[model samples]
Target: MSDHRSESSRPARVPEPADPPGTAGARTPEPVPAGVQMSKQSGTPGAAVPEPPKVPAYARQPHPRQPPSPWGPAGRQPSSDLMKIRPAAPGVIPAATLWSVLATALLGALLLGDGIGLNLFLVAVPAALAAYFAAQAAGRRLRPWTAVWAVGGLSLLAVPALRDAGWPVFLAVVSAVAVGSLALHGSRGWLGIFLGSLGLLTSVAGSLGWGAHGVRDRMADSRGRWGVAFRSTVAAVVLLIVFGALFASADAAFADVLGSLIPDVSLGEGPWRLFLGVIGLVGALAAAYTAAAPVRWDALTVPPGPARGRLEWALPLIVLNLLFAGFLAIQLTVLLGGYDKVMAETRLSYAQYAREGFWQLLWATVLTLLVIALALRWAPRGGARDRTLVRSVLGTLCLLTLVVVASALRRLDLYVDAYGLTRLRISVAAVELWLGVVLLLIMAAGVFGAKMLPRGVAVSAAVGVLAFGLASPDGLIAEQNVQRYRDDHSIDIQYLRGLSADAVPALDTLPEPLRSCALDEIQRTLRGSDAPWYATSWGEARARDILGDWDPGARVRNCQELGSGDQGNERGGDGTGGPGGDDSYDPYDPY
Candidate 1:
């Protein structure tokens, strides 16, 4: 207390010695949080200021959000003018664009038609874009010279293709460009643009090659980027015309294939009309799907969702689609008035057909929709809603199951027709097959995908294509598609069971029926060869040496020679196993 009194009796406040540097007399605001109030003025004695605390590392420094204006007036505020008064063009697409497009479109042109070829050519667009994006990602621009080089490379490849006018060459060149661009710039955007232009060029080339381009003489057409658009229009028109001409010319071709089977007047005309009709329907279906669904075309994929164990969420959409497809098929037939009946006794046209089943389908659809509305209404809240979703979905599934079961119970024939997911139409079947495979792929791509199922499915599909009918043990039916493809003209499998010399040797080693078939194949194949594969000399040598003739001492009689049993090493009937110790792998034998 005495010390405090002594200090309080001090005369005046001591001032620190100045003159290290004279004060600038500038007022400094105390460091504070942004919105804190500051004192109005300093006291008579200079206000005491606390030493500023060290800033924490986690504190963020303020910065301008955007770049400074470029077109600012001097000493005045700059305007946010990223845009110039004018922009320049990239210049005329080089001649190489034509070559690239022609190259790309050649395959579809030869195999399908110019219309289909044009669609294939669009593949180049993404390829080009891929290269551009890649280069951009690597912190580089695709210079004009690079574009020139890429185009030039594509052009160089086309010289041979143009000379040959073959799709093989075209495919090679465009693919080269696409792949080369991806390799060089890593999927640049320019790759897409360049490829698109090239595809258009190719489409035009395809049209010309197919003898259709000259038909567009009425329009002013220039070849380049615009050439694609021009060619697309010309190709569409020409294809339509060409189809018309072919239909008129080949009455026999049309009548033999479709006239008796499909009685619709349009279908009776020719294959072309049928094809176009199918394509148009498919396109309409796709467009309608896009319109109805929230998903974009790019995202036309099945994504991972709630576990399949909780099937309630998934079944509704699935049933809806199935019913919709059925509804559409019936509705289309009715709307098109495609049905016609031939007289039973007279074998002549009887009555004009009106379509059936649309009204019933409509009523059922309305009922299903009402059920869905009711389900969504009283569902649980938040994530628990998923569980509540259980009821409606199960209900819908039960309803659908009942329908399928009821249809089954009504009549065996009707049940097969109703419940069979595979539609009768060729187009529908193809679509179904494609969708099935895609669905498999999607499931494979999921987190807890159908692993065991995918492997078996993939193997079976491969076996189907690889074995075809030729791989069958019976030799009468194909291992996979059997006679289905032959009747339908949908699949062609001439090259299945392509065994090498290292694999199964000659035909006779195989079990019967197959042995005869393989022998037949050998005979047919070796017919024209300088050194025939199944010639008597080669056959004998192959049978004697590679086939190992027979085991010790079972008298082997030959189909070719009776006493030649002495020439071929014979096998004894000591049937414990083979001479090599164990050759018996009988599929029928149980352990």
Candidate 2:
């Protein structure tokens, strides 16, 4: 009885609160099955302690100082975790393989394509491959329609007319953006497409981070194998260089043979070219990888505000409308008056009057477009009177802009007819045409609201430019100029002769005497026996097809014989020429 009393009386043991789940002193609760009985050794008889279910590391709270991860939410992984963990199935392409392929492509591009036209395709092929590799790395799945678009867009470069148009960079940029947007996001909404395309620039640093981590893991696993390979490769390269130099210096015949095999590598140019090639390759790879795996894009959002008050927009628009109305009246009066009378009143020549109005009117059209866009973005909600006034003002502005665009086009056409058609004049004419289309689009948007109008306009304009490039710029210019020459006999043969290989195919469509002269000049430029087979391009191939069995000696002799038979001082005293120029005077100086 006394022993029992002693056991009971010994100060009852008090349990400290068990440490909260993950503290250092916490005990892992033991698992208990249903109906299990606990002994006195347990916290309490007939009671079971159950283990807490494990939580994933990501789900668990991290250390307070640790920043959240750039890639995902867990945080910057510790060295241990980085080594043990695996990225998801997506975006896990083997880094080494991609790098090797890119390196090989860079080497191939450097070895091929001596001519500028061929070089464009060589550069483009690697660029496209890099983009595809990046898409794979980014975990983007290509859809069927997108794949077709990509194929068709790239194939344009292989077309003789399109490639020779000398707009490769322009076409490639637009097409690549279209393809990349399709891959990154299945939708082609303008905002998403543009944002995704822009995001490629920001992805470069992220790609480097991911790639560096992957390389580090690979290096750790096979350090010895890599070390042996690297050492052996370095030794072989060094030995070859030393022996080649020694043998060549010892014998002239050997040096000559070596020169034939390897070519004379300038100490300066060789390193410079190699350095530029490396820079271009790395930049391309970085861009491609970024496009494949884009991070967060800054979304397009409207400015936060209520529509602007009527006082802010109404007064200015009314004044502008009045001004535009007055300008239109004056233009109409000038049109009613004869060309000579208008020029006399303005105290300007026909050429000056035509040139001056086109630029000023074009500028006015651009400014008016900007004003209308701003009004749409910010003009306040109002009563019916206010709304009617706003719409009317906007509608009037659009109408006035159409008039301006038409007048500008007319002026430009007159200028071209007076000076002969040129690349610049033709480009300006195309712009004027696009602006007219945009004005019509703006008018429709005014009635229906402009939520997608800007994007639609951009897409249309880009497509229009691409269509023009594909149709062949040189061909268009030559056709127009040849027609003008037939009408007035005011042609600049020397300028036609000076055009790039792109113009060679087009010149074939000209009349006999002019055609022969143009072909001879172009043939002289392409004459080089050392051009590599890999440098063969669509443009050069087309030129060869048109020119036919060329003999350099015969072409030069024909040109000299033709030069002696010239009729007038059409090309100046010494047959050296351009618009109002001797051989030394540059026609492009006026522009």
Candidate 3:
């Protein structure tokens, strides 16, 4: 109290020191809490400084809340220029734009010319263009990968070989194009590829109202104009119906002419086909657009939420590995025992032996791959030792599974050799071979960790498929089986005759009656068949030359009826239909 009284008696106030260099002026005042007030300055001599009175909340108006703005609490000042501008384009597309796109696509389809191949090429062009326009309408920029996608798309459209490469090849080409396009447009990775593919499959339905508002508004505006036209058309239609009925009643000839003009088309006829085509084409365009400008799927690349159970990954895989190992042991025994010995021991016919385990082996191979994937995803991360064990087991399982695939392939080969090759067996064999390659890749992934395994597998699978398509397996299979027939005299003449025109050239090597009969059946099948313009390839022309009007269906012949010397003659046959009388048939001959 004495110190306070003494300090209050001082006459002169001390000046505050200046702030240090570079410091901003004294910090702004913080909001004072309620019931608090600034302390009074000491008075001059005996005079006391008056304190500011506290104001009640109701009596005092709070500073008007500053309007919110991105700039700051004070908000941004208006620009000198008065014209208002939009900040940026939104991520979404407008509805009217989509309707316009759909209309453009339908119109394009109508003008693009007929045939699936031509339409496929034509539709792609407009789909890409519409996608671009949609991006612009939505204020988005073209993606960096657009050029790459464009090149790929143009290649697909321009290459006649690729276009005519059959449905499987065509689908592969389409998927590649779609994935490349999506990737260029910013989405990437396996998930992106999957999403892009899904987009292609369902985009048409998915985009049902992608940009509905603008389209609806435009329709509303046009409705007034359309209303008058609609009413007038309805009135004319009513008048025609009424008068036409009367005229029909009066003149039977007129009625007959009217009926002829209108025609009684059924649901299964041309009108339905046209309707379906229109719907299909429109949907295709929508899907293409959606695929090209898909909603963001990149975020899905984020790691999965919550780790899966450790046992779920480990226990099933351990059991599966044991099963696969056991299967491999049995397979090894069969593989080593020689085909004849195994068949004798099992008391099974050659065909039964070949057919028995192939499908089961194939299924097991598929299940092994799934198990590896699951194990990689959820295996216990308890310690380095656990991870090493899992990887070792998975890798071993994959290697063993590959052995199973090889066995399955061997079985298929035997079956094909016995029955003569068919398209189904050949295709399945190719798939199994690819699956083996993929398992080998998975083994590498297990050893080295899955850094680029998915990418490696995808590329390898794509290359394998493209190669398989180009190899013309049908032609190759026929060539091999025909040579086999020449060697063993065990060929199924009936099966050979039943093969598609694809096998005609290969069949030309058979002796007189069989060769002639096979050609005839091929010719008949060719005549009855209708290949689309896009489906025809150079191979078809070669097949036609070999067929040459022979008729297998008209003639029946057994091995003996083909002549006892026929086998000897076929073994020496030249490339021509007539058999050469020497063992000159080279099984290794590619043609």
Instruction: List lDDT for all candidates, in order.
Output: 0.33, 0.59, 0.57
lDDT of 1 by residue, 25-61 (tens): 6454434443233343566245444443444544534
Winning model by lDDT: 2
- Candidate 2: residue pairs that collide: 134-292, 138-292
- Candidate 3 lDDT tens digits, 171-276: 4566556544553345455565456445454455445555454446656877876578669988997999899889989999998777644424345555554564
Note the clash tally of each candidate. Answer: 27, 2, 9
Error of 2 at 358 (Å): 1.1
> Model 3 residue 223 lDDT?
85
Candidate with more favorable, higher lDDT: 1 or 3: 3
Q: Pick the candidate with the highest TM-score.
A: 2
Runs with alpha carbons beyond 4 Å of true place in candidate 2:
1-91, 94-161, 165-198, 215-284, 300-306, 329-349, 382-391, 505-517, 529-535, 549-591
Per-residue lDDT of 119 in model 2:
47
User: Global CA lDDT of candidate 2, please?
Assistant: 0.59
**Model 1: residue 4 alpha-carbon error in angstroms:** 95
